[model samples]
Target: MNLDDDIALAHALADAAGAVIRPYFRARFVQEAKADASPVTQADREAEEAIRALIEEHRAGDGIIGEEYGAARADAERVWVLDPIDGTRAFIGGRPIFGTLIALMIEGHPVLGVIDQPISSERWIGAAGRPTRFNGKPAGTRACPELSRALFATTAPWFCGGFEALRSAAGDTLLGGDCYNYALLASGHGDLVVEEGLKLHDWAALLPVVEGAGGRMTDWHGQSLHKGSDGRVVAVGDPALLPQVLELLER
Candidate 1:
């Protein structure tokens, strides 16, 4: 498949997700818990359905793995990963930090990804072998050589058991930004973001975005993250800080 065309489709998929998600943001949409006890709402289902429609229209042979809808066509060579709202808790709490994550996975690796924030009208697209862009302009990250000098963030502290250590290592740890935290890291607003319990859909799109913007992300073991990763995450805006940051988090 032509990656350029797939990137465009990823962007459009993100847009489709937003069209359904915006109306329900902070609005009373019936929410229920999945078997995992995570929240799922009409917005999530509707958004994934919308994206699925677009993919079916464009790449019917491709597969899908979504938060709301489980995997489909699991053996396909190409797959689309969707997390309609990467920060559903923030969305339910009326915060705009939540985002729609869309990724095009080829043979279990993300080749194109997009993080779309409907409320803010912001979008970040990162495609392998291409420069990352924030709202169509080149976006790059700032470098911070030391962990203590870094501004760090995470979806929340309690999600990770070693949160206190990570906070101590960074000098400061701010809570609650989900995918926005990664976007912040990509845009150079935050230096690092760490989280645990992320699924493939949760971190796949952010991986290329972070790395494309002169940043890097990996599982806690400092190995490259792939479809089967266990979901312990560490993302850094400056690649130089990855080792020390991983050292602290892993310890």
Candidate 2:
């Protein structure tokens, strides 16, 4: 398969999904929950359905694993991992930090990823062997040499066990959800993004974006993430800073 062609398609799909989601964002809407107790909104379901329909029409054989509606067509070698609205809480609160996340996994590895923040008109896209870009400009992680200078973001304090260690290492901290933090990390704005309780959809779309931007991402144990991860993710711009943060967290 031509990876670039696939990545471009993924980027277009993400943008389409974002357009479907942007209108209902923060608007009056009903809220509900999934079996796992995560919040779901009208925007979430609508966006997922729109994206699913588009994917089915264009790539009939590809599988899809979505946050709002669950997995479908799971046997295909190329699967799309999607979080229709990565930061639902932020979206509900009228914050523009929320985004639409889409990732293509071949075999068991992510090959292309896109994070579209419709509210801000910002799009980040990356592929395994291609350059990462933000709104069509090449982007990369910052060059922070030490942990003390790193800016960190986490979904929440309760989600991860290594908060204290991260706090100790990072001079500043910001709280946010899902792909937004990863978007910031890839755009050279944030130095590190660490979280726990992540699912495949949460980190899959983000892996290529981070790695393509000269950063590193893995589970807490420093293992490469897969479709069945236990929901822990640690990402940083500089490779040198990763081991130090990992060592501190593991301690």
Candidate 3:
């Protein structure tokens, strides 16, 4: 499949999601607690369904793995990973930091990805052979040499599940960014992001966005992240700093 076409489609999917999600944001949309105690709202379901319908209409053979909806056509050469509202907690609380994540994974690796922040109207796009862009301008991560100097951010320490050592090693960490953290890292606003307890939908889109911006993203052990990853992720703006960061987290 042509990658450009796929990239274009990914953005359209994000736009479709925004159309459903925008109205619900800051409009007092009622939220429900999922089984995991994470918040879910009518906006989340409707947005996913809207994106799903578009994908089905355009790319019928592709598989889909959504946060709100379960997997569909699990075995396909192409798959779309969707997280309608990556930070539902932030959304329920009327924060614009929440974003819609869309990724197109072909034969197991993400080739196209997008992080769309509807309220702010800023979108970041990354593809296999393209420069990462923020609102169509090329962007990349900033450099930070030491842990203390780095502007670190995570969703929450508890979100890391049991990676307490990793969280503690990050020094003073910022509170939350959900998908926005990766965007910040990509656009040179943040230095590092460490988080855990993520699934495919949560981490897949981020891989391309971070790496395409001349940054490095890996599992806790410094391995490549993929579809079946266990979700211990560390993203660094400068590749040279990864080893030191990894060492600290190892402690």
Best by lDDT: 1
Clashing pairs in 2: 198-231
Residues 114-228, model 1: lDDT tens digits = 9889999999999998889999999999989888888889877776657877778785778888899999889989998988988899999998898899999998889998889
Give the runs in model 2 whose Cα sits over 4 Å from its true position: none
Clashes of 3: 0
Put down candidate 2 lDDT per residue, 1-251, tens digits, no spaces: 78767876787787778878777876788898778777889888888888888889888899999987888887789999888888888888898988888999988789888999998899999888777999999989989979999998887888767898888779798876568888888988888888887788888989999999999999888899887788888899888888888898787
Q: Arrange candidates, best lDDT first.
A: 1, 3, 2
TM-score of 3: 0.95
Better of 1 and 3 by lDDT: 1
Model 2 TM-score relative to the real fold: 0.96
